[model samples]
Target: MSSSDIFIGEVIGTAVLILLGGGVCAAVTLKHSKARNAGWLAITFGWGFAVLTGAYLAGGVSGAHLNPAVTVGLAIEGGTEWGKVPLYLFSQLLGAMIGAVLVWITYYGQFQAHLTDREIVGGPGAQDTVKAVPNSEPGPVLGIFSTGPEIRNVAQNLATEIIATVVLVLAILTQGLNAEGNGLGVLGGLITALVVVGIGLSLGGPTGYAINPVRDLGPRIVHAVLPLPNKGGSDWSYAWIPVAGPLIGGAIAGGLYNIAFA
Candidate 1:
């Protein structure tokens, strides 16, 4: 595909990915949504479905490498050109931002209620923990848009991301080595989506399983900038772990693929 094709495909695919993914988060977290408090199984499956939908929609055009870590891993494995990596990353980030904004718009009322409902009696639920103190840091609502460590240990969180991302990228690399040469042919998308669901279920408990760099960063940036009511801090301090650990893990996966699988 040409540059424009790759860019547009990634943008649309990633936007859809985040839209559905964030939508699920909003559904489970927000007060008024019908799926409120649906729990983590719904989220894991929802995100898997999101990946399946996005990859299928964009797979024909740009291979549907919507995550920067995926793109980097592919490039390191000689599956993608170095020159195109920047475009892919930029498009993914842009798509993530756009998707996040759409989520905010879709759940505008819910977010408002979720944020301010703390004043009201039994507002939202136990997840609605942020009280929004004056000038206080970003609150717990961030989990809807981005990932955070449950234990808050930098080394442990980073290690979790790296290890989980290795599993993810390695799965992709293995699946992509099919006869078709396309990274995870149409059926592989579904399988990869399941792999993501697996990661979320098995390894996600520690750090929310943010194995994708753009997936976390884009929405986190939107969280920081958007004028949502009483939306707490963006948690910039821990942002680097998701990005760096995933990149490191992806690169290691590529290296491992080269040494062991290739």
Candidate 2:
């Protein structure tokens, strides 16, 4: 694909990916939404479908490496050229932010209703009380925008993200081998979507399976900047785990593939 194709395809593809993926999270978490309390299975399946849709949309144009981890893994595996890496990463991040904004717009009313409800925030006047770090934690709706750990252990959280992302990028890398080195081909999107769901079901309990650095960071940035009333801090302190762990995992997967699978 040409540079413009890659750029356009990644921006659109990644926007769709975050739109549906984060959209599912918002559906399950936010108030006054039909899919509220839909549980983890719903989220995993929703993300899988999101991946399927985004990948299928951009596959023909940019090979649809929507996740930066996938892009990095492929580059290390010699599938994508190093020169194109920056474009892919930049486009993915930009697309992810756009998608997050779309999610906010799609569920604007729910967000407003949820944030204003005292019970949702904590209690009466909780909105004013729920301050950042020194006083309290991030706001209630932050989870809809970014991943956070159920348990706050740095090593454990980092390891879980790395392992899960390694599984994701490795699965993507090997799919080409199964297809006789023809790339993902027609089944690639579906296969990758299923793999994402599998990872979520199996390993998502820890850090919400960020697996892709841009996926988490882009939306988290959006969360920080959006003018949502009563929304708390963006949890910038723990943000590095999602960004660093997946990147490290992608590089590791690439090196491992070269050593064994390639």
What are the lDDT figures for the candidates, one per model?
Answer: 0.86, 0.89
lDDT of 2 by residue, 121-150 (tens): 666565565342231467789899999999
State TM-scores per candidate.
0.92, 0.94
For each predicted model, how many residue pairs clash, with residues at least 3 apart or on different chains?
3, 0
Off by over 4 Å in 2: 125-136, 177-183
Model 2, global lDDT: 0.89
Query: What residue pairs clash in candidate 2, if any at all?
Result: none
Error of 2 at 19 (Å): 0.5
lDDT of 1 by residue, 83-162 (tens): 88899999999999898889999999988777777553234552344444332454656888899888989999999999
Best by TM-score: 2
